[model samples]
Target: MYSWQNNEYEADGVTPKLSEAKRGPADPRLTQSNEDQLNVLLGAVVNYDKVIGDHTFNILAGVNRETIRNDNFSAFRRFFISNDIDYMFAGGDAEKDNGGAAWERARLNYFGRANYNYKGKYIAELLWRVDGSYMFPKDTRYGFFPGAMLGWVVSEEDFWKDNVPFVNYFKIRASYGQMGNDNVYYNDELQEYQYFSTYGFGTYIINDAMVKSLMESRVPNKFITWEVANNYNLGFDFQFMDGKFNAEIDLFKNSRESILWQRNASIPQSTGMSLPAENIGKVDNSGFDVSLGYRETFGELGFNVAINGGYAKNKIIFWDEAPGAPEWQKSTGRAINAGLYYNYAGVFRDQAEIDANTIDYSDITGNLRPGDMKYEDYDGDGKITPNDRVRRDMNNVPTFQGGINFGFNYKNFDLAILFQGATGAEQRVGTDESGAIGNFLLDFYENRWTLDNPSSEYPRITDRSDQYYSNNNTYWLRSSNYLRLKNVELGYNFSTTWLEKTGISSARIFLSGQNLLTWSKNKVLDPESSNALGHYYPQARIINSGIMVSF
Candidate 1:
């Protein structure tokens, strides 16, 4: 059995005090406030066993309990200002201003498995488990997660005894199970206090004929629900050549139902609320995985290699109507996981060419001119509209990704090399094309429009900048594909005999380096690294050396 407890507190008193002449006797402005939190947990486990003939079965059970408390207090008066007016004020301090909340829960789990052997040639085992969490509503919080697998050794079977001479080991196995998450935000069911106020009349005696008015608002969404996910997987494992080579492959599909998402509909303005949490969307993912390993020895030289790779496709399954959404918005389409702006074609060569092209170049913005990028009238309606926009060729997900490693051992020395890379990705580039061509602090300024640089790639500077430099779909996208050398290391392990003489079990030394090299066509500081489009934090290469010892 085990138990634990924790406590925390916070206090604040920095706001300026109100003068007696300007303060109202009935106001509840908090000059000081305090808050505290406390939590405790207890847990225990028990086990049992049973035996019959040559087989045995075991069972295990566990229980856990937790409690939490929160306390808040206003030592003095409190007041909130709204619309430049002290409209709402409640009188309370010390005991009258204090509030507290508490919650408790319990969880239990059970597990069982059995092992048996028949005729020494065949072996089998069975396993199962059930787990529960208390984060859900009392009626829905508990769930059972059970798993089972079966295994068989073909070499032990007489079917392949004479024909297969080199094959030494073989096995076939399978399993299925269900799992759940109760990770919802704490206090999601409480409509807690939020600070806001509105304009109102001052405290003053008035005639019965006089009229006054005030405004009030309430918070929304007193409770929220939890999200759940389900998954299924199947795979196989194989080994041969005296266990020198092995491989495994798996295929899986997962679905996230009732996912928690913020509703996009506008809330009543009188309540000053905009978004609320709801469990209303669904997402699905499917993928395959493969892994291979091999080891061989030739005289005093040894070789080892390993390879692993996987790919997955994701899509949105469902979403209800989004209130106040535009007509262009629709349900059951691939989620907008990523986007890329259209490329900007250079301007028309001249006015005759622009007119001959049947296009209007006047509405173009920011450093644009008659010789900038050419625009295609996608709709063929003789007008430039959103219909003319084109999608980029590359999708956001990396099409191919993997790594390779090689190692060699000779005498008392060793050498190793590793390589990894990723390909087929894209990112948006952030550039400055807004400032005056000659006066702006832009990197492209040094190469602006000029007779010597007349064929410059960037647009020319002019007073009608807004007309040429608009932030359209054409100016904010770029490809982010790249391949990089992730890491490298070389180490030598001393012979065990040498360490044994000194009463030590083992000892060794080595050196290593990371992010040591890269190869790519990306133009930015480092195309391989980006927090997000337009925001990048450069990473530095590193190297180090170290030693290990066991005694």
Candidate 2:
């Protein structure tokens, strides 16, 4: 259970009439909210294992159900003689807008799986599940998903032992499955308006009398159902040198279809009516992940090291749109974070060069002058119009990310460290996006072009030319590659013989540090997070020393 309360004062200075949007202490407002939820669950499981000849069978079945609910409310008041008395009962005016909401949800599922193997060389497994959610109408509330996997252990075969003594084991497996997402919103849970029509009161004046009229605020679609994801994965595992070295790798692909997106934004305005949500979008995401490790002993010291990395890329394959946009205006078939902007050539230094340039100044900046951004005539038409700009999609985010970790041990002492980073990423910079003026980095003005400097890299600092510094372009894109010392730790274990009289069973001391160092060309923010607006707090450096003991 949790409870919340809010109290605030708003000075009246800028509004013609005071209301909920611009409330004053005459509103002597006090708001409170209390919320609690209870979930009850029941489940049953049965398992069976049998061995017949050279084959083994393992099976399992289960059924589960759960229920949950939440409720909340808040109220406001106005025209209080004393600000100390803030409750609704102590006020002279009733709040025009005070309400609350409550929602209940339940889910049920039945699932089963079976596995079988022959001589521990060949393996196969199958699974099936039936799930139901109250988010949908009763007529089409249930969904069925199934999955299967198969594997082969090549090292189990005798032929490998005689042919490759150094190789210990090798196995390969693949799986395919489908899943359902009951969450209707891409970022929020299902809401009452998503399931049915929603209504609100509209104020109107008729015959010199004020009246309240009921109006539909949201359209409804009863046929909406599930957004589904179909996935496939293939993986392999192997070991060498009697388990001294080992590695496992997997590749996966998934397609999420029938995604829920409110189509009202794309509907044609001529229709004169607003629309609702529908299953009209799709996305395809695929990536691979792998890991490797090694362990060895030298004299009394031991070495265990591992390095692993992976990458993922996604694109919007399908979406709903109006028919009249330019072909380049549509960003489908590109990475979701892709962008388009004008192309930057260089900065103009003197008026003579600006007058001699082939670009038609009137086409872009009617009052063109020196020290403004020089834009390329990508279309080669001698006119730098909107059509001259091009579309691009890359370097928005790193498609590859990975890390290297290793550790060493000698008797009672041990040490470990990790180096991690990402590549193939890019970001845009400038006061317009990340921030501006007082928020500029210390080095922002260091190399900027000036009358005495006339540098080609940066334009003169001026607010007059929006076309130069305010526009986005390739010039703003910066590489986001970085190498960071992620974590390091050193520890030593106390020997039992040295602590014979201490009465403690075990004890150890350790020191650890995180985000100790970073190397990169990115100056705006942490490269990994792409913090442009300075909204993100830079990663913190953490160090600690602790002792552990058990009795």
Point out where model 2 deviates above 4 Å. Answer: 1-27, 33-46, 51-54, 66-71, 94-96, 186-197, 264-266, 326-329, 357-369, 380-391, 430-438, 461-468, 501-511, 543-551
TM-score of each: 0.65, 0.84
Instruction: Report RMSD for candidate 2.
Output: 6.8
lDDT of 1 by residue, 1-551 (tens): 22222222224444333333443555434445567777777777677776667555556566666666666655443454433443224433333343334344445555555555544434555555454554444454455655555556666677765667466766565555555554533246532211122233423336855345553432233343345566666676767798898888877777777665544443444555544445667887778778888999999999999887777766678765546443333334453354424347655554465456656544443233454556665546665555455545444566456777777888766767777766666655434434543244243356445544654255554332444333444543445566566667777788998888998897778888887887766554466554333345565788978888899
**True-vs-predicted CA distance for residue 244, candidate 1, Å:** 1.1
Cα lDDT, all candidates: 0.56, 0.78
How does model 2 score by TM-score? 0.84
> Candidate 2 clash total?
2
- Cα lDDT tens digits, model 2, 103-214, are 7889999999999999989999999888888877776688888999999998888898779878899999999998887777643654544666777777899999978899
Model 1 stretches with alpha carbons more than 4 Å out: 1-35, 49-58, 70-156, 160-167, 182-225, 263-275, 320-336, 340-400, 432-480, 492-511, 525-528, 533-537, 545-551
